[model samples]
Structure formats: structure tokens, C-alpha cells
Target chain A: MRKIKDLGEFGLLRELGLFGQKLPEGWIGPGDDCAIAPKSGGNLAITTDLLIEDIHFRLSTTGPRDLGWKAAAVNLSDLASMGARPLALTVGAALPKNLPFEWAEEFYKGLRECADRFDCVLAGGDTSSAEKICLSVTALGDMEGRSPLLRSGARENDDLWLSGEPGESAAGLLLLEKGLSGGKALEKCLRRHLCPEPRVELGLLLAERRLANSAIDVSDGVLADAGHISERSGLKVLVEAGKIPMSRELCACAAKSGADPFELALGGGEDYELLFTAPPKNREAILEIGKGLGLGVALVGKVEKGSGVSLLGEDGREMEPKRSGWSHF
Target chain B: MRKIKDLGEFGLLRELGLFGQKLPEGWIGPGDDCAIAPKSGGNLAITTDLLIEDIHFRLSTTGPRDLGWKAAAVNLSDLASMGARPLALTVGAALPKNLPFEWAEEFYKGLRECADRFDCVLAGGDTSSAEKICLSVTALGDMEGRSPLLRSGARENDDLWLSGEPGESAAGLLLLEKGLSGGKALEKCLRRHLCPEPRVELGLLLAERRLANSAIDVSDGVLADAGHISERSGLKVLVEAGKIPMSRELCACAAKSGADPFELALGGGEDYELLFTAPPKNREAILEIGKGLGLGVALVGKVEKGSGVSLLGEDGREMEPKRSGWSHF
Candidate 1:
């Protein structure tokens, strides 16, 4: 396990910068008082997210670096969902009295690393005292000339697609909770859960190429997130259960824990994968985008002229999961 | 007190829009993914702040509308300190479990009100669950083709000035904490404490006219925030006790509480006024701008070729306040 203090503040941020590599159009990519990005004709994209201690993470299970990374990632994910490129981030942190300065520095390092990776800079933020640590990150992005891809844009007959493997984060969470480890494979899953990557590059590719009709990030499980698309688009979506992708490590863990891999794949959260839809004509173009970016592209379902989301079981029956995944409130 | 629930989600935002009438140059003012602003021809000005329950405020005392207002104001205050004009804002809210939907609506109403007042738009944000309510707001601003006014810009022999009354918010807080209720005067002070308005217009005027050599908002307190200027600029500032302006209401409350008005004015936080310095030549211009804005401006101090901040006591002796103000550790 990596301790946040091991990297210090600046060191951790340096690591985060490594992951955020692509720049969206019109953004002067971070490292300033504010990020300037060209918007829909000159409009900019801005979003914020807040994560609380105990409510958002437990220190015993999560490290400071991961917490900081998650804070920025969640906000950036919102920008991605809107088809915006991240430019700058500002953070507000409330630390408990007992928190060490070194810990705070490490936390900032993680945040800086993540911001730099996306070519975004840590502009400025507020710090204060609290009984528990709390973090809030606001991400700014450029919209360029593209219309933001909203959750409401999926029309009837559009094809729904996902950017990468689903349910891996949830599987990692399950493994962490049970104290079960499977060496390198389990390590990868657990890392995915703790430090789920935001699909900013893939989102930008879709927006740049005008391939996605609508897009969303799978933060709260495939079923629930897809439900958002269904509700907003006023359309029905049929997802084939077997077609949902799962890592082999996740499958093995599910089998060992007596959990259904398919169920986890559908109902797990924190995947941070891009879930989008487009016309059938865009299929080949999107696939080519995936190949260019070295990301997996999966066509999972289709949009129909009705409301609600359904699942197709192996027996050719429509099925609903026992739960609808996680909800903030 | 206005409850956040009184306004529906979108209604509250609409109410907020009423306040955002004026916009600075090169700003894609409000209502997008992010606010876009040009700083120094190419740079941008960004800042973020977070407020949480039992940390920044208590619901029993502070109204939800005020919370929303303060969240945006604090971030805007940071931009003002940098001599930047408000552009756009993003928010991240974490609501408690079993939270009423109306609470969020009312909060957004307050947020919208503040943003609109500052000509800022609520761009985009994320909402999630928490054990307590948390708000994180990030404000983007334009530097108007000039370098941002950093804390390091003050030079020796510069004249120090303050816009509006100081320490009213802190005085207001003392009254609230002591549960000391007076008449309308106390009520006014309490309101000031609850909702400290950021001096955005004045800041812009100063920057536009190039009247200030350096600037920062009176957030942490006069002495502490001035200390940032001193540390960064490597110059000492001698603040005149008599020159520090106080609202009549604040003075009256302080007298009743047997508190030193000067001490409160120096060490109390959340004033949200602009504290700036300029060469002696700019004095007339500064005064003219203040008059044009109908704002009360005062010459409070002078920057000297030394390090540290000092107060000129009535006895002609240098005095330091017992407390330097709030420190977020």
C-alpha cells in the first residue's frame, strides 16, 4: 500500500500529472489564476464537486492521495460528461485539527498531479479547520465550438456504447471489503476502484469527432447511469447482460464471493467509464476513435421510443436487478 | 430569514440571475460548463472555496440562503483580491442522508442570487450525499489583460487603502455567538456577518484604472491578510488605528460587549472588503473611483521598506493585536 506521506505534496502532484495527458481544444491547459477556455462560441465549461470525510471516504481504507485524486476526478468527470475538456481546478480543503501538515501536503500533491496530468493547473483554493477532512474541487474546461453532449440527447434508435470495461471498480471495492487479495490481478482491480480513471480523452475524442449523440460517465453503476440517460432522453434502453464487459479478475472474485459477475457489472459504481450513444452511421467512426486512443469500445444496447431501462437475460427474458446501485441521497 | 426551500431548484437560480447584470471584458459571463475569461491577454483567474456544516457554519444560526451566498462570495472574494472580475462559478454540494430536496433548491437560490449580483453564472456542479451538508464553489474571473494583483506586488512607500467598513462580519459573528440581541442596529450587523458582500465592483475599478499597486480581500482579517502582503512583498505596513473605518452599528455593538473596536477591526475575519495599496500619485484617482461607486474609501496605512505589520496606537506606540485572526490548518 502506498502512503500519501511517501510522496510528499509536490511529489504526489507530479504523479497525478502523468495520468492527465490530453488537452481539449481552446483551453490554455491549467497553471494559472484561472483556466481560460473557448466555449460554445466563447462559452467556457465549469463544474465543481465536494467530498466529505466519513461520508465520502474512510481514512482507514483510503489514502490521502487517492482521496485528493478522486476529488478532482469527480469534478473533471462532470466536465467530460458534458463533452468539455478540463483546463484548471481549484480545491477547498477542511482538515481536522489532528491532521499532520505532511498529510495535507501529500493530499495536495495528489491533486496537483491529477490536475497537471490533464494539463490543468491548481489555480487557488481555501483551507480551513474542521472536525473531519473535507475536500472540494472545481474543474474548468473549454467547450470550443461543440455543443455539449448532455444526458438528454439520446434519441430513439441511437446506439449506446461504453468506453471501457464496466464493474471493475466495484469488483475492486468488494475485494477490498472482504480483505481478499489475488496478487497482481486483484491489485489492478483494487487500484481501479480506489483510483478510477476519468475517461476525459475518450470523451474529448467523441466530442471532437462529433460521434456521440449523448454521453455520461458511469460513476454510479451502469444500470443507474443508463437510467439517467433513459429518463433524460425519454427513451427505453435494452442492455444485453452478457455483453457487459468484466475483467477476469472481477469474475474470479465474484465467483469466490458467491456474487454474480453480471449483477456486479450492471449494478456496481465508480467505474468512471464513458457511456454514450450515437447513430448507427457513427459506429465505424467511433470504433476507429477507440482504436486510435487504445481504448476498448463496446456497443451494448439501443435506444427505443419509450421510457425506462430493461435488461435481457440469457433466457431471453427482461430482468431487473435487485438493487439500482448507489444514490447520493 | 429566507428558507432555501421557498425557491424551487430552477426558480432559485432564476432569482440569482437577477444580480448578475454587469460583466467585465472578455468574460463569457455565467450559464455554461465553465465561465471563460481572458486574463492578461491569455491567462485566467480561478479560485475555489468550500464551506461545511459544523466547520464553516451551523444551520441553526446561518440561513441556507446565506450559506449559498457566502459560498460564492468567498470564492469571488479571492478573485477580487487578485483584482479580477467575476466570470462564472461552479458548485459542489454534498447533502445529508434523508435531506429534503427543497433545502438544495433554496441553497441554489441563494447561490444564484450572489452569482447574479456579481454578474457570474452558475456554470455546472455535482451533488452527492454526506453526513452533513457541504458546499464548494469555484469562481472564475478575468484579469482584464493585466497581470493579476498578487500579494507580492506591493512596494515600499505605497499608500494603503481599504474599501468600505472593516470587521463588521467578525463583529456580527461575536454578537451571534453571544446571543446578544440589540435593536435594528444589531440586526444589521448580524446580517453583515451572515452575508459579507465581496467588493467586486470596487476591485474592478481599481484594476481598470490601474490605481492600486497591490490588492487583497480582507478575508482572514486585516492584520493576517496584510501579513500575506508583507511576506510576499517583503515590506512592512503601518496601519493607523484611527483611520480604520467601522460601521456605527459595529461600534455600538462592540461598546455594549466591552470589546475593543480597533482590535476587532484588525483581527476579525470575513469583512470581504478590498485592502489595497498604491503610489501616492494614485490617491486622487482612488478617491474619485470610490466616489463614483458611492463607496466609503479610507486611507488606512502605508507600506514601508521593512517586513511585518504594525498598528499605530493612540499613544503613538506600535501595537499588535493579541490575536492575528483565523488560520486554517
Candidate 2:
């Protein structure tokens, strides 16, 4: 057997790949954020995420409260991707000794508030002191007997949809980087960046209604998330650049920063919007849901027979953007 | 309200404690490593722990494999405390870019080996880059309809038992710190420190047989863990110092290091042995289970109608140690 040292991280992961040869029925192991236990009779969805200081957030702009909220929100986003209803959350934080204890309290307050809003319990967590602050959060959800929305389920010609505006958080981040001195547009973007809400209800609605064939959260950007769906489903995602929903606030923030609003909407990350695929027949019903829920749900693209992701201009011309999305690795 | 800074981290936690009064049935809101959702038909126990570089372990001494094993082991120890059967694990690691990829692979390999040994699934986890290597693992288990053993369940006159030697890990750490130059004795202590095995089977037996009233894993040494039971159960734990089980190897290590073996057994942490309380009448049943499992189970003390923990020296004199056990914060 080859030693893991020679294989590298990804390579070793590939070799250790879920130990698929031994998995039980309904067990979806390691590759996904949330693993489904088939033996549970299909009632659980669990997901986890890590957020480190500097890498995940800049202390200059984010305080403990925002940090706490974002920590829970991101993992909740992963649950949403699985079309899971939040039930409880477990948090783990490593703080520096000099950190104001009050700051940690503020962070918990934010986490509590988010959990409350989601009707989830802030069940348990471990806290310790470290050289720098880091957070790990796990969100557990009830599948309610519904099959999860997998990234690899899109059928040919399935319409791509967005639960809300994209790239707002990224735009907000740019504003934060520029100094939080902008107008309402920048403030809105900043809030979006600081506390991007996950589309839990929308995800639940999709799963319950059996509307979405494939789904993922737009944490890494629309194009990048779409890539996961494309690669997993073995189909091409033809994104309509003009069709991606954008708030006037996002546009104004982009304008002030001299950045392209469309590009921000397409390639920027951390919006926590639901990016999903549904059969074209369900478009009307999905749009009705958007109206009923008072949340924007727009058709932004379609799944094609080919593979990978391609963008189309309003004029129906294929265009290539500068980058796909943010990558932690 | 006073600022959190005024409250300090501990006060802040106390203020934010559990959020239990607000939780619904089947919800165990915080305060424990694994929170039980009583509604899961009483089948689940969930727990998480965070380990950071320099604080939890020195990267210079601990290779990635041991780091991974310890990360999983510590959380598993928590599950053992609850008498929950290991089911699945979700891990989140923040790695530095400069970290050798091979190290990460070795870490996963160790994680895989441990999970496999325990019949638990390494279901899923997230990986990201950070300034230092940090690991967070969440262990999910099924309690199998057996009520969880709480740290607060001990009653007056309940017999306290230790599954194995206490402070072996702590002694091992001392040896490691002193440099493992002694003979097999030092090597044994070092191994105990680096790879302390969790008493999962014994915990399961106790829970299943109703042998223990309150149980906890000795991660922070017998005194500290007993203190948890003492405080929670609102009773005094009278530990008989001479009764604490210690190996000949530990005595040798202590002689060389000039440390008291009894003190090391009492105050050293990370033994990962079970410290539990049981009725005196169940001694025969407990002994039988121990014999069946071929594991050591020795009565170390008794629970009394008081508060806090007090140690009686070999000569029956009360002794107060300078510290309880290891504390991360």
C-alpha cells in the first residue's frame, strides 16, 4: 500500500474515498458536507463548516455578533442546500486569552438569535482559548421523510433558479474593504455580507413540493455553485447573465466601487441564496412560491446536454467571465 | 446589563447557559458536549470539540496522524461520558497553506482507522486553509433507548469506580515534557499520553446494565472529573487516594521524575478512563461485566451527602492538591 505522504491531501482523500466498499445502504459518506444515514429511515441531514479569522472574516469589519451569526448562517446554508429543516446547531470556538469575554457573549447572542429565528435549538458547544479565533459549526436538520436535493440530479433542460439576489454579500465585502463609508447601498451590502440569511423556507418548499431536481447554496458564487451542479449532474449549465436577479443596492454599491454589477452578481460569493434546478413545468409554481413567500425566485439559466458551465449574454451570445468563484483551498 | 467584558468568558457562558428554559421537549439546549433530542425517540447523542495548534498540541511533536486521532478521540471520549454508541463523525479542519499536504493525508488516515475501529462512519467534514492547523470534530451516536448517564446523577453512598489508571495520559505528558529517556516505563507513559484509548465498550455496558448512576470519562483527571459530578450532583465525592489504581510502570516513571504517583493519578488529565458512580448493591453485577469485558474496574471512593470533592490520603488524612486537573481555558 502507498503511504499517504506520497499521495498528498486530495489524493489521500481520493484513496480513502468514503470507504465506499464498506458503506451500508443509504449511507452517503465523506464527499458531501452533510451525510445521510440510510438506516435512520431518512430523517436527518447534517452539515458542518469552519470559519477562521482573517481567512473567513476580517476583524476590522466584523465584530463578535456578526462573526457568530455568519458562523451559524454558513452551515445552515449547507443544510438548506440539502432541503433540510433546521432543528439544532452545535458550535465550537477557539478564542485568544486577551479577547474580551463580553465579545464572546455578543457572538453567542447573535448565534442565539439566528437559531431562534430558524426555530432551532442552540443545543451544545465547546469553547476554548487559542492564539487566534476560529469557529466550527454543525447544523442538524430533519429531512421530514423527503429525499434530499442532490447537486447531481439536474435533468437536461431543467430551469436554473435563484432564491434571491446574488453577489450582494460580496459587494458588501468590497465596501467593507473600501471602508464602511458608503451610503444606503453600501450599508445594505454590508448587512448582506455580515449576515446573509439562508433560504431555509425556500429550500423546504422546494423539497416538500418536489420542485427542485438539483440544488446548492450560493456561498461560493453563482457560477461556482453551478459548477458543482454541472459536474455532479454531468450536464452543462447555460447561465443567462441578464437574468440573474440583482438588487438596486447591489448595483449602486458596484457603481460606487467602479465594479461591474453583473460580474459581482455572477462571480461574487456569500449571498447564501438557493441555486437550484427544476423542471420547466414547475417554473410557474416556483414563481408563485416566490410571490407567496415574498422572496425573489428568478430563472437564471438552464441545464443543457453538454458539460461544464457557460454564460450567455442577454443577446444570446456566449461570454466568459474572469473567474468562477472563491475557493478556500 | 454589564458588558461581556465585565462578565468574562466564563460569566458570559453562564449568562448564555443552555438556553434550556426556552427549548422544546426532546431538546437538550447546551451545557453538555452531546445534546440529546429527546424526541429522536431517545436514540441520539451528539457532541463536538475543538482542538487548536500550540494550545491542544504542539505541531513540532504531534504529527498530523496523532492530531487527527486525538481530535476524534477527545470527542469520542465525550460520547463515552454519555454512554452513547458511536455512529458517525463530521470533521472540520482549518489548515495553513504551508502545511505539507502529506500531513493532512496522514491525519485522515488515522481518523479513518479510528472510525473504522469504533464501527462509526466518517460520514462527512469540511476542509479549509487557515493561519494554523485547527480541528473540530462532532461525534454523533445512538443511545439505543438507554437513558444517558449524566454527571449529575450520583447519589449519596454511591460507589465510585475507575475503569483503569488515572492520569496515565498526564503522566505520559510529563514524561514527554521531560523527554522520554527512561526505559519501557517511560515509553509506556508516552504511549498512554499520545494515544489514550476511550472506554466506549465499558461505557456501553454500564449504561445498558444500569450499572452506573452517573458516569464521566476522565479527560481532565479523576479529581476534576469527580468535581464535575460533585458540583452537578450537589454531593461530595470522597476519593480514597490509596485505592486509586496505578500500574508498576507509572510508579517507575514517577520515581524517575520525582513526582508523586498518587498525585499524578489524582490530578493528571486525559486518562480517558471511566469514572462512574453505582449503588453498592450492584457491585457483583458490575464485577461480572468487567470480567466479561476483561477490563479493570476498581472501586476508588464513595459519594457522600455534601458538596465538592475531598481526597483522603493513604493514611486517611485529608489532602488538598494545588490544582484539580488540566484546563484549556
Candidate 3:
């Protein structure tokens, strides 16, 4: 018999998508960062994320504050992918009865801090008892009359752009798993893994300037998310591994741990950076916008007339990946 | 030394409320059924509910289809409490890896059925792996330029009205716990427990006519919910135990189980009925509206200028409750 493990997370999501297709006019269903629902005069973009203890985080390596911050940031990153302005968020938590009240206070403190930093309000939520800690954060944003940046809008010949560095978060996780944490570089990687920063400003700016044709958050690795754009847009995404940007911390951590940086960069998940496709003509403007926000923008690849994603090595040859990305199953 | 269990669910919620007070203009935060966010043209009401396996329901008693339906219905009931018209819903679920694919298909079928029946759309969601099944359903509704019916709006001398009987679901739960299920009465209670119908129609009518001064859904028992109204409105709620409606199915189940029917009627939960307050002068109009809708509306209580909730017995003497309601902690 086919089980959830056999179908896998992506397969299960694909099957679930069939049940939500008949949405209302101007409404976008599953498959994007946030679902779009047209309200009063504008569109409301919403996204939800579920995080389970041990599956997503371990208390030994993660503090309550960081856990809460990451939970809210991940959902905000979804809104950012849609170029939606932050508005509000609701958090539903299932906490173990034996958990200390101080842990909850610290968690909410961190969650509120993140929402406040992003100019979003803490809305409402539900709390219940559970044997394990479970969190569900739902974030709502406003489109402000602009069309949402969907994954299915990447045109052929569009340049693939990524904000910030990838692989640092995965490298940090490896370090934590190994119980090795010290030095400035390792500390930076650990921080990245614990508390990811959502590119909300760049997302809103891109939408305001109409810069990008397609966008997605780096929750499922750059290659896997690029595959999403390919499947939705019916185009091929060719990513140049040599051109993928890497942080110094990630490189140091990889060298110390005897791991390949490219593998982590291409296959690791939960970076919360924005990956987008834009017309080649807007490269300079996009670069300038990134500079204005003090963020780095890397041109990694391009869209082509085909299907699936391909990783080209420095030798201009396709490289087979050891692992594509993290799968829940 | 204080743990979540010591604080209890309500106490924890009260503490959480402090973190959400400084909201934007025209926005309501954590104290209502759904947080109210002023959108482009009107207000949007959003509420989220979390259901954990064993904590909220046991897999031995609940089928996958019923679990999905109940999850959606509970969130919709919260929206109904605000008198908001249902718009869209997002579901976040964490399922064990060993679960069969057919279970998911059945679950989504029931979830879609309930959402479709209420004119709501399934927009987007997240799914992950967990040790036990955990479901988080977030529902959104539109106020359509009308003021929301708030729990804090009950005025002195207002009549407290309840739609539908309140004890059937709890009685049904008791029967299931006792492994006793059969006959028409027990079957009816079981259905009520499995597939609860939200008071959407009655809520809309009351909001449309401005007939309700305050409103709340009966998820945490009638007395506890009335206590919420009293605390929020800074008034007193007085309920006549004899006037509280009791379903024949609930009575039969309670009698068979050797449980007190009045205790279940006043302090049991998960009924999804609307407990609202209206002016004494609007009693006839409210009764006519209920008759037109083919729904039974019973006047069982009153709001007075005092504090807290008080339950009066058949002889007009205050009755002390043995247990107020379900407490997560």
C-alpha cells in the first residue's frame, strides 16, 4: 500500500493541490508563497507554515526565542516571495503541558520582536496542549494594487537572481549536529540558521518597480525552488554552480567539516533568501536596488525553453547532485 | 517553577494578550474570536485553531473524514462568532509518515466538503511530518462594512440568547469514551460530535439586522463563554439553568451514562452554537428571525451591571459548578 513516506512531501503537496483548484475569481490557490484573495479594494496575500519539534528544531541546539523568531520569519518570507507588504500574523501553538511558562514568554518576545522589526502586527491565534511542541504561523500581507509575483511568470531568457548567500544555514546545522560551535565564522553561520532574515524590503521594492517576472523563497533550496518555477512556468531553469554565491563562513565551515560547499548551496534548505527571475535588461537596475538596501544580488543562471532544472559546473558540463534537497518523508 | 499546566490555557491567553495590544488604528488584536484587520475597503476577520491527536481527539474514536470536517468547522465557528461572512481557509497539517495515502484523500474530501458547503474556498496550506497528527486551520471572513459583533458589546439588561442545544456533543463524546454507541438518540449525538455545523446563517442575519449586542460561539461551554462576555464587557451574566435548552439526544445519552444532564448542558463544550446578547425590546424580532430560519432560539440568560457569570437553579438559587469547562493545561 502507498503510504505518506512513499509519496514524499512534494508528492503529497501535489496531490493536495488538486482539492484546492476551484478558487474564486482573482484568488490564487496553493503552489505559491502566499495565496492571494482579492478583498475590499486590493489583494490580501496570506501564507501559513507548520513547524514541529525534533522535525524542525531541537531544544538542545535552539533556544525558545530563536525558535519563535524563525517560525514567524519563515511565514513572512513566504509573503516576501509574493512582493506583499507586511500587515499582520497569527500564531497557533500546541505546547506540552510541562513546558515552563518562561519558555513561552521568551518565545512570544522573540516572535513579537521579529514582527515588529518587519512592521507587522501580532494578530490573534489559538493555543492548545500537545505531547510535543508544534507551531503554526499565518502571515497576511497587502498587494497594494500590484499584481503578485507568481512562480509561473518566468519567461524564456530571463536571468535568475538570488539575494544573499545560501548554504550557511545548512553548514550551521551540521556544526550543531556535531556539537562543534566556536569562532567568528561558525558563530555567523549558527546565527543564520537560528534566525533567518526575510527579504521583505527587496520584495516590496521589486513589486513597486515591477522588476521581477517570477519569485520564490529559498525554503526548499535554490535548485528545488527553481524546479518549482520550471514546472509552473513550463520552462527550463539552468543554474551555474560556479556562479552561485557562497559566504566566507559557509566555506570555512564546509572545509572544516569536509563537506562540499556547492552541495550545500544547491541542495540545503531554509535560507529564507529571495530567488527571482527578471529580464536581462533590468540587471543593472536590480543590482542598484540591492546596493540601495545594502544587500548582495547574485546572477546565477537563466531561464530557457525546456523543462526541469540543470546545474552546470565550472567546466560548462551538467553536474549530477548527490541530494536534491531536504524531504520530510 | 510555574509551568503551562499551572497557568492554564485561559491564563496563558491573558498573558499573551498583553503582547498584542498596540495594534494599528481600526485593528483589533487577540481578544476576539478573530483578529480584525482593516483592509482596503472593509475589515477582515481571521481565526486559527489547533487540534492535536489524543489531546483534542483520539484516533480510535474519530475517523479521518470526521477529523478534517471538525477542524474546519471549529475555525468557521470562530468566524461566525464575529458575524463575518466566510471567505477562505488555509490548513496546516502534520501527519505521521506511516499514514496511508487514502487517509489523506478522505481527510481532504471532508475538509473540502465543509468549506464548500459554507461558501468558503480552500486557498493554501502547509504539510509536514510529525509523530502524531496535528491540524491547524485558519479561517478568514469579510465583515462587508458592518461593525463586528463583539463579546465586549453586551450591555446591561440585554437578553442572552442561545441557538441550538449545547450538550449533545459532549454527551456524544462520553458515549464514545464509554464504548457505547447505538440507537437513534446516541447516533444523533455522535453525528453532532463528528460533524458540527457552524451558525453562519444565524450569525449573518443577526449582524445584518444589528439585532445582536454581543456574540460568542459555544466552544468552551455556555457558562464559560458567558464568563468571557462578562469579563470583556465589564458586566455580569446571569443564566437560568431551567431555561437552558437540552437536546433529547443529550438527555438520553447522559441518563444512560449516569451523568447529570444539566451539568452537561451548562458546562460541556464543542456545540458550535451561537450565544448572543440582544436588547430586551428586540426579543420578538429575534424570535421571528429564528422562526423564519427554522432554528430554535432560547432566551436563557441576561446581562446585568455587575461582574462575572452566575448560574441560577430552578428555584432561583445560584448553583456552583463542579467544573467550569475544558482546560487545556
Q: Estimate each model's TM-score.
A: 0.83, 0.94, 0.97
lDDT (Cα, tens digit) per residue for candidate 3, span B136-234: 999999999878999999999999999999889989889999999889999999999899999998888899889999999999899989988998999
How far off is each candidate at the interface, as Cα RMSD in Å?
A: 13.8, 4.2, 1.2
Docking class of 2: acceptable
Per-residue lDDT of A102-175 in model 3, one digit per residue for the tens? Answer: 89988988898999999998886888888889899999999989889999999999999999999898898989
| TM-score of the second chain for every model | 0.86, 0.93, 0.97
- Who wins the TM-score comparison? 3
Q: By TM-score, highest first, what's the ranking?
A: 3, 2, 1
Distance (Å) between predicted and true CA of A301, model 2?
Answer: 1.7
Clashing pairs in 3: none
Give the higher-DockQ candidate: 1 or 3: 3
Candidate achieving higher DockQ, 2 or 3: 3
In candidate 1, what are the lDDT values of residues B90-132, reduced to their tens digit?
6666666454444555677788789878877565455556666
List fnat per candidate, in order. 0.40, 0.50, 0.85
Q: How well does candidate 2 score on lDDT at residue A13?
A: 52
Location of the lowest summed lDDT over 10 successive residues in candidate 3 chain B: B13-22
DockQ of 2: 0.46
| Model 3 chain A lowest lDDT segment of ten | A319-328
Runs of candidate 1 exceeding 4 Å displacement: A1-42, A314-323, B1-42, B98-106, B144-146, B314-323
TM-score of chain B of 1: 0.86
